[model samples]
Target: MKKIRAALLGATGAVGQRYINMLDRHPFITLEVLMGGESAGKKYGQAVHWLFPDAIPERFAEAQVRTARPESAEGCDVVFSALPSEVASEIEQDFAKAGFTLVSEASSHRMDPDVPLMIPEINPGHLELLEAQKKARGWKGAIATTPNCTVTGLAIVMTPLLDNFAAEKAIVTTMQALSGAGYPGVPSLAITENVIPYIKNEEEKVAKEAKKILGAVKGGAIVPHELPIGISCNRVPVIDGHTETLYAEFPKAVKPDQVARVLERFSGLPQKLRLPTAPERPIIVRRENDRPQPRLDRMSGSVPGMSVVVGRVRNGIDERSLQLTLLSHNTIRGAAGTAILTAELMQKEGYIG
Candidate 1:
């Protein structure tokens, strides 16, 4: 099988760097193009300021970075877009029309029925709608996106319960890392020792994206569920992982141990597919009381690519709900890792050549 040649738009930014590191050894993809906005024209090594401890891989050192525009991405079989939402909406649509499969991390096209915004482990079934999307838009390729980082982590924790029982509503509070905003994101004065109670559009993204990800695909389109997620999104001074506290009310009465068991042992459709980037466990239920801390365990092997670590499971306010704390590598499992899994699903399903 010929290797799938791919491009990374927004390749000079934080999320793009994660895509680079994840794709460094990807069995199915070749990093054929690296495109950025202001950072265009530099080599990948120079364009990117390495933050994560992992060194930049040799394959990407000399790769030239170009303008992250559609015309510059010629010859790629798929384009994993880590571009900002506004920029991504434009470039991704053009690339899809140009006949390249677009697995995007941007939220622009996420709500479109034609575009499948996915967390492969939680909702691989949604990708089925991509066929109708392509035909409707008269495009050669389709777009599949990962939900927002907070949504990705939150949804993974909810899936097993949603599958076994039914999720009535959820009240969540997220302490999102500054990195979610991008490189040089929050200024020192703003976040040095502060916790801003509100993030501009994050709460909306978390609420809306969760429903789309948990939605079902029917008649070649997704019908989003009417589940309500009351959310509060905050920007913390933390550098890497985003942590979320959730109170999920289930229709059935399930214990904390039951939730732990479900999260600990559950592996979804993506794991079964054996997608190269799919983690063996999508959600790791940590037993240690203080586990899943950003500095100590956020980058742990549980997320070799696709896992989300969830710990501190306990009873919620009432008998009908359960409380848990979850953590995910903002750029890895939340951004690039999910994008890679989306591409793997597209490849196995023959969306890409």
Candidate 2:
């Protein structure tokens, strides 16, 4: 099988760096173009500030960065976008109109009714929306997005619970990592000693996007989950993982052991197809009381950073409520890795072949 030629848009930010790392040795996709804004005319190595622990790959180090224009990406089979939401809305559509499939990490299109806000294991069915999107927009290609990073962990954990126990309401409080803010993020003086309790528009994104991700696709449209979700987002000093505490009210009583059993055995389309980036266990249940901490569990999974580590599953204040803490690598499973996995599913389903 020939490798698909791909382009990386917004190739000089935190999320963009993750895309570069994951695509460096990807089995099915080749990084053929690098695009950026101010960094457009420089070599990738010179343009990027280089935040990741791993050294930038030599193959891409000397590749010239180009402006993110459709013509610059003409021959690529797919475009992996990490552009800011404000800029991505227009540029991603331009690429789609110019006949390129876009697997994006931008928040701009996550709520669009026609675009698929996908979690391969949780909502592979939503990809069907792409057909409607292409038809409605009159484009040869389409956009598929992963939800906001904060929403990713929340939605993944909620999926199994909703399937086996059925949720009536959910409340998630998050301690998101500093890297989520992007490069030159929150001044050290502000974040080093204290936790900032708000992220502009984060809480709303988590609440709304979760419903869409866990929603059902019907009659050429997605029917969002009716379950009510409330969220509070905070920015912590940690560098990589996002930790969330979930409290849910299920319709009926469910024991901790039952919830653990369902989460431990959960697997979806990515696992069945054995996509390279998919973790063997999407959710790793920890029996210890002090587990799932960002320092220790952020890298949990066979594919490191691909799994969500869950702990402290117990009854809440009442028999109908359950509480637990979950941790996920914000940049990997929450952003770039999920986008890559979505593209893999597209290939398997004949949407991108």
Candidate 3:
């Protein structure tokens, strides 16, 4: 099989660095172009702050960073965007208009009626919306987005429960990591010893995006699931993982054991198709009371940082309610990693060649 040529936009940010690490020796995609804002003319190594503990990949060390314009991505088949939402909105569309499949981490297009805000394991069917998106926008290529870092874990955990027990309402409270705020994020003075109770628009994104991700595709549009999701987001002192506590109400009575069994047995399109980046198990159920901690379980799957760690499953406020805690690597499973998985899914579904 010929490798798909890909480009990375915002190549100097935290999420962009992860994209670089992930694509270093990717099985199906090759990193051919590196684009950034102010770092456009410098070598990638010189421009990037290099956040990861691992050294920069030699392949991209000397690569010249180009400006984040569609024309700079001329030879790419796919464009993986880590660009900020403010700038990504226009630039991503430009790439799609130029006929490049775009998998974006920015929030710009996640809720667009035609765009598919995807978690491959939970909503592969939603990819069909890409067709409607292209036709509506008159673009040759289409845009697909991964949800906010906080929503990714919540949606993935809720998927199996929703399927097995018809969960209709959810209340999620998140203790998100500092990384989710991006590089040089949250001032040291504010988040050093305290928990900032608010993140601009994060609560809204989780509430709306989850329903859309869990929604059905019909008549060329996505009808968001009728389920009610309420969320409370907070920025914590942790460095890498986002931890969420979820309370869900099911239509019928459910036992904690039953919920665990369903989650343990759950697998979706990505798992069935054996996509290269798919985790062997999308959710890992832990029985210990204090499990799923950010430091211990954030990277808990066969594919590290690809699985959501779920623990402390128990009865909620009533017999019809179920509650559990989940942890996921925000930058990996939530942003860059999920974007890569979406691209792999697009390739498998023949949306990208």
Backbone Cα, N, C clashes tallied per candidate:
0, 0, 0
lDDT of 3 by residue, 1-353 (tens): 56799999999998999899888989889999999999999999999999988899987989999988889999888899999999999999889988888999998998889999999998898999988898999999999999999999999988888888999899989999999989999999999999999999899888899889999998888899988888899999999999999999988899999899888888888899898899999999999999989999988888789999999999998889999999999999999889899999888888887
User: Which prediction has more favorable TM-score, 1 or 2?
Assistant: 2
Tens digit per residue, CA lDDT, model 1, 217-325:
8888788868888999889989889988888888878788887988888887778877788888888888888877877767666446366888898878877788888
Q: Candidate 1 clash total?
A: 0
Q: TM-score per candidate, in order?
A: 0.95, 0.98, 0.98
Off by over 4 Å in 1: 302-305
Alpha carbon lDDT at 107, candidate 1:
86
Off by over 4 Å in 2: none
* Per-residue accuracy of model 2 over 1-353 as CA lDDT, tens digit each: 45788899998999988989998988998889999999998999999999977789998899999999998887888899999999999999999999899999998888889999999999998988999999999999999999888888888999999989988899888999998888988999999889999999988888889898888988777889988988889999999999999999988888998898899899999999999899999999999999899999999889889999999999998988999999999999999989999988888888885
TM-score of 2: 0.98
Per-candidate Cα lDDT values, in order, are 0.83, 0.91, 0.91
RMSD of each: 1.6, 1.0, 0.9
Flag the better candidate by lDDT, 1 or 3. 3
Report the C-alpha displacement of residue 86, candidate 1, in angstroms. 2.1
Q: Which ten residues in a row have the lowest lDDT in candidate 3?
A: 1-10
Displacement of residue 42 (Cα, Å) in model 1 is 2.5
Candidate 3 structure lDDT:
0.91
